[model samples]
Target chain A: MRVLGVDPGLTRLGLGVVDSGSPTRPQLVAVGVVRTPADESVDVRLGRIAEAFDQWIDEHRPDVVAIERVFARSDVSTIIGTAQASGLTMGLAARRGLPVAMHTPSEVKAAITGSGRADKRQMTHMVTRILRLDAPPKPADAADALGLAITHLWRGAVAGASTPGKEKDVLARRARTTAGTGLTPAQQQWARAMRAARA
Target chain B: MRVLGVDPGLTRLGLGVVDSGSPTRPQLVAVGVVRTPADESVDVRLGRIAEAFDQWIDEHRPDVVAIERVFARSDVSTIIGTAQASGLTMGLAARRGLPVAMHTPSEVKAAITGSGRADKRQMTHMVTRILRLDAPPKPADAADALGLAITHLWRGAVAGASTPGKEKDVLARRARTTAGTGLTPAQQQWARAMRAARA
Candidate 1:
């Protein structure tokens, strides 16, 4: 399955496409960034981002879209822009009948590097190794986009599979590393319940 | 000039349409709310809002669109949703090549009641008086939406006018009541500069 991952931002949005041949292996299809001038009006910047998203989706035609979930706890100033950018991505994907999955920073880290608290350097290194790229993707955001795609492939596919035991193992591993997941109380409870059910 | 005001929100988006026959006079064309259930996914909610905005713009054929300027200082949980909704509104307006104006809560209050710090009751009263309506509009969001349209009509038009002196006088009057106008530092400076130039 091919997945397109988006790291949403107002000034610079990162996009990556990955084709998963197996649950353990995924190949990079493409990676790039769409930048909008900070001087531009919000609407104009959003229009540019929307156009970029349309072009990427049309060209890549990924089976699913994965995006970094916007959280309120982060830098308050950029939250609104991040959310708006993420929203545009999701809306565009939905318009095309594409299933979209949102992965938090921690979730992406854990899925890619086996630690929710993994730093950017670790994430970049792991993404390079996972994709078997000769060099790491530039501009941390692009690497993050790929990480989101990888996370979705690992978690989403496992969850959808008929193998409940394997799903439980993945969920348990995720739960153990949920320390920095930035999940809401309700979400944490839901995760705990799922783990318990699988147990 | 006809203006469509959008009070952007995820759950209850308010919309108001007004026609300005004169700078100080605006007639209410219509007012309504678009409700999205909390149970729906974010993409679905945004899609519904996009459709509603499209229909409103198509039907009203407004000369301009006015929307509330989103602030990061608001409730953190809702800020993302609010920004997304606002982005959708702006995107749609931009796509149609319609001029869009963003008015802060203070600006809306000031335009409607001549007091930036006006309470909800005062805003409703002024809106009722200004529109010559028998009763105040239901739902505070709808009234605020109308207030936004009125604000844009009064401020945006004057700013773009060829008469600098008249614009300065109007802006000075607004500045006098700037306590609730929520003008950013840059905006305040721009207003001051305009007043000085006219002087």
Candidate 2:
């Protein structure tokens, strides 16, 4: 399947296309980036994002869309950026409610580089090596987009596996056995590992 | 050096202390959990965290504090949980004026396993293997606490001898770079690693 991977940003966005029949590795189809003027109003910038998404869809005709889910942010500006990035991604695949999968940054890094804590250079280098690109993807945007594509394939490799939560169920049972341990079984995190296994 | 590792949670807070020089992995001098009833007010829970922290410090007297830093939370409840957790951790550490170091969850995971995306089971399993424990630490809260401890030792072993900036820095850089392509060299995340090697 052809997967469209996106890395959203305020001033620039990265886009990439990859073919994922090969589980161990995938082929990079196209890698490019989009730049938006940050000084514009929110509405205008969003319009640009929408327009960019439309263009990408028209060009890639991806069978799947994979996005990097945004998480905790304190600053309003950053939160806005994160939402924009995440929203733009969702918007692109919104039509027909495509089966979009969002992976955490750690999940993506781990899938791509064998380490959740892999650095950008590591990720960039891995994306280069994995796709067998002649050179590193330009700007960091292209590399990240490519990483998203790689992450999608890794996720697809084992999508419905048991997760960390199953282990939580086990811990819950243990807590019940140890009653008055002041620990509730459901509250036990070990059992939760089953869900992580799924992730 | 003794490093105290903490895995913060709003409901159940975990703390661990390990000595850095004992072996390849630090010895777990002490570990325990503090509980806060959801029925209690936030301040009371925080007070509970404080009391637990005081008890641990008095008993363990760890030389350094290593905490898992909070990340972007999308849910209000989760964000609140994270904020409470952060406040409790910082408040407890600050009261003693202990040197505190924050590592993102991924960093801790990476430091423990080669992969940052390793779940709690993987983490717990690895922790048992790395610490050479006779039995796996029961209750993931405790297991996570142990994992954080090992991560500190691993990073400390390679501390300043290699790259800098925790995984978050790289993720954020990737976020910006992945979204947009106009990353300035100064804003580039890998520049630090590349420059350090050059020097």
Candidate 3:
């Protein structure tokens, strides 16, 4: 399956696509950043983002759309803009009938570098190794976008694995993590990612 | 001029329209809320909001779009959702080539009521009176939506009025409010509303 990951932001939105046909060796398909002028009105900037993202979706035609979720508790100045940008991505993906997956920054970091506390350099290094690329994707955000796609792909593999023992282990781990009823599929997949990281 | 005001939210979005052809006697054209099931995914919910808001823009064809700005510092739990929903409104308005106006909650309250610290009841009362409605718009969000439109109308009037003395007074007040250069028109209009309220 092909997955498109977006690290959402107002001034600079990072987008990366990965073809995950081989779960063990995901390949990078595209990576770039979409930037809007800081001087533009919020309305115009958002509209431009939606337009550019729509074009990305049309061109990539990925099976799933993944985004790094924005946390309201983090960076009060940037959270709102990040959330707004992510909303456009989510809405666009839904309109296209594509499944939307969201991973927290920590989750993506953990999945990529085996440590939720990994720094940017570590994540970029790991992504370069995993994708077998000559160099890390430019701008930390672009690497983060690729990391989100790889995270989603691995979690999805864990979720849909036919190995009964591994599936049972994942379910047990997810049961402990969920702690509440009615978790979304993406949330459940995050739990699976957490479990796989621990294993 | 016709203005459509949107009080954006994830579960309940309030929408109101007013025809301000006569600066002194604004008339209500439409008022209601758009609701999405809380159980739905964020992507689905945002998509639904965009679709419904597009229909609203097509149906109303307002000269301007007004929305209450979401602050990242306020109510961390709901701030992200509010920002995301408001983003859709702004993006839609921009795509249709309509000017988008944003008023802070305090600014909206001050414009509708005499005080920036006015309570919800005061706002509802003033909205009912301003729109000459027999009763207050049901739900506080609906009243707030109308308040946004009314605020925009009054501010737009203040910004465009040829009264030299009043324009000079507004410009002086706006100079005080704007700490730096490059304020958006909406920001300048907000300053004008603050000046008019004081007057």
Candidate 4:
């Protein structure tokens, strides 16, 4: 499956594309950031982002679009812009009949680095290693977008058999349970793999 | 100037169109609500809203779009959805080269009922009287949408010469000043009119 991951923001939107390779590795297709001038009106900025996103989808032709789930509590000032970008991203993908999967920040971290508490540096390091790239994707948003695509590629693949809406529902329930325990399914999977290797 | 007002919401979006009739009495061109099912995903809902808004603009051919400004502090549970919808509204309007204006909730209330704290009933009542409608617009959203159009028709008319971005900046500054003093420009205008009538 070809997946496009987006880290939605008003001023700078990070995009990463990946093609499913082996069970544990995904091939990097492209990674970049789209920036909208902060001086413009919010609507104009959103329109520009929409235009860029439309172009990206058309060029990449990804089967699925993965986005980072925005939480209102993250930053009151930037939350609205983030949410708007995320909404636009999802809308554009859905309009094209592409399935969209949203992953929490922690989920992406856990999926890429084996720990939900992994910081940006750790996430960048792991994403680079997993994709077998010589260097890490630059500007944290780009790396983060790659992480989102990787997360959906690994975490969402099993649940991907069902309808998109139902798949999200299942993932959401699992996310809630994982949040309650301060662990993600990815983290658990990593732990099991580590134990098996040790044994 | 013809204005299309939008009360942005994920579930039920209210839209109102008005034409510049007389300075004091604008004519209501149309009023209605567009609904997206709650069961649908957020992206699908946004897509439906975009489609409806596009059609509305094509049919009404409004020179400007007036939308309610979404504040993140209001109702955390719904704020994200509201912001997304508002963003999409602005984007759609901006894409079609139609100027977009946003009014605070208090500003709309003051413009319609001469009180920033006017209740829904008073807003509905005044909108009915101003538009000379036989009945209040069906849902509260519809009434609120009309109020937005009327506010822009009156409040925005004077400052309409400037570019839409600059006009919004000026209006935003004024909104901040008005909020601090607990009165909108509309409320002050209403007070002056009352004094003139008494004199």
Candidate 3, residue B15: the lDDT equals 94
> Which residue runs does candidate 3 get wrong by more than 4 Å?
A161-199, B161-199
Q: Place model 4 in a CAPRI quality band.
A: acceptable
Q: What local lDDT does model 2 show for residue B50?
A: 55
lDDT of each residue in A78-124, candidate 2, tens digit only: 55454444544553364434556667778888877778998888988
Candidate number achieving the greatest lDDT relative to the actual structure: 3
**Residues forming the 10-long window of minimal summed lDDT in candidate 4 chain A:** A190-199
> Could you give the C-alpha RMSD of every candidate to the true structure, in order shown?
8.7, 23.0, 7.0, 7.1
Instruction: Identify the runs in model 2 with alpha carbons over 4 angstroms from their true place.
Output: A1-199, B74-76, B161-199
Ranking by lDDT: 3, 4, 1, 2
lDDT of 3 at B7: 94
Better of 1 and 3 by TM-score: 3
Indicate the TM-score of model 4. Answer: 0.82
TM-score of each: 0.79, 0.41, 0.82, 0.82
Model 1 chain B: weakest 10-residue lDDT segment is: B190-199
Local accuracy of candidate 1 as per-residue lDDT tens digits, B42-107: 887887887788899999999988989998898877988998888878867876788887889998
- Checking candidate 4 for backbone clashes, the offending pairs are none
The DockQ assigned to candidate 2 is 0.01
Give, for candidate 2 chain A, the lowest lDDT window spanning 10 residues: A190-199
